[model samples]
Structures are given as structure tokens and as C-alpha cells.
Target: DFRPHDEHYVQNFVLVTHGLLMRIFCMCYFRWTVLEFDQVWNPQNCEIWVLEKTKKGRYRLAGSWQEESKSFGPIKFGADKTKLLYPHMKESTPARDMVPGKPGWLDDPALRHLVVAAQFGKGIGVNKELGSLG
Candidate 1:
């Protein structure tokens, strides 16, 4: 039960299975944006797609580098076309993380590879699940 602006609109939904720790996020858009459009659907703007992890174990939205404030971590792009990393970034706070090494959580080879691959738009033998928009 996830809604962007209003709960009644119900633009997206997320469900998680307790036992398996499996999670699924489904987005219903009024119009298809570049980020969600696929060839098969051919939907003008209204469409829905589920963002899931690849077989390689990387989440769908992982590894999209974006500008961030010096204080906070990486800035993330929002559905409303807004950049959201640090809600309260200010001049006094640091602009970015200057450490050389990658984040400790992403030390795994598979994760690093996936990040590199996604950044370059190169397929890494991973398949995306596609479903009907209607």
C-alpha cells in the first residue's frame, strides 16, 4: 500500500514475504517515463512495472551514480524528478564522501561487477521480468 502523493491514488504497491524475505515493488504510472518504458508494452503513459532484483542479486535501482551534497551520501533521483539524498544538506556539512574505497557493503565482486555493468548499460547475462501494463 504505497502511494506517491495520495493514498487513495495508489500509484504503487509493495509486498514483502516474511519467511523468504522476498520483496516486490509495483509502480503504476499515469504515463510511461523513460525509466519504465519497455518495447513490448507500447503504453503511452499509463503503465506498471515491478522492480526486482536480478538473478545476480543486485537490486534494480542499484548503481545509478548521481550528484550529492558534500555532507550526505549519494543523491537519489525521485519519481517526481527531484533529487533526494540529504533532505537538510547545508553549507556547513561535508559535500561528499572523500574516502577512496568503495562502500563496505558493496565489497563483493558480484555486486561491484553489477554496478559497473549497469553504469555502462552493458548486459551482464541478466534478464528482466516483463509483464503486461494493463
Candidate 2:
């Protein structure tokens, strides 16, 4: 689980998954929805959705990017510094990754291409399961 709040979020801005190892960054162009924080005591219980548009032009869950993961509120906003919260993200089966042995939906060719190109000297190895990210 990773929650980025600084330059690392800006520079290293791609999700990588190789076998059991998965690193994610929540910075994609998602049609998101927000759930307000109701009570101060229940800070970590709030959630939001990172949505993707379906072929029928409807919104569905892309990933659940948590605003707070471990009791600490990872996202903050507003005038009084209100903590924004979301549920922990889980890998979903996209319509694309439903093919045999593909596993997760983030294994698309275009995204993989970007990951391989961007990860030259970043110490992050490309996926060995499918030969390469691209």
C-alpha cells in the first residue's frame, strides 16, 4: 500500500505490477466521485471512487483510491484542512484483462508501453511475467 503526497507522486506517476509486487499511483484522468467526511471521530472511515466510463456511457469502479489507509488520513483539503478519505484500492478485472492469463486490467498495451519507456533507470523492473510491460 502506498500513499503519495509529494514530489514522488509528481515524478513517479505510473502504476506497476509484476507478479506479486504491485505499485500504484493515483493520478489518472478518472471521473471521480467524492464522499464527504461526516464526523471528526470517524476520519478513516470515509471513501471515494475513481470511476471509468463504460462503453454504454456509464460510470463504473476503476479503482478505490483510499484517502486514509492506516488510521492516518493520507489526503487533506479545504480551508480548515479537512481530511479527505477514500477506501483502499483493489485490482479490478477490466473488460480488456478478462482474456486468458492476463490477470488485471492495467495490463493494456498503451499503459505498458508508457511504463517500459518511463522506467529505464528508475530501479523498477518491467513485468517479467509477460516478457515486458510493452
Top-TM-score candidate index: 2
**What is the C-alpha local distance difference test score of each model?**
0.27, 0.33
Query: lDDT score of model 1?
Result: 0.27
lDDT of 2: 0.33
Q: List the residue pairs that clash in candidate 1.
A: 31-45, 32-45, 69-95, 70-94, 70-95, 70-96, 71-94, 71-95
Model 2 lDDT tens row, 82-127: 5332332222233332242355433654234323432322333345
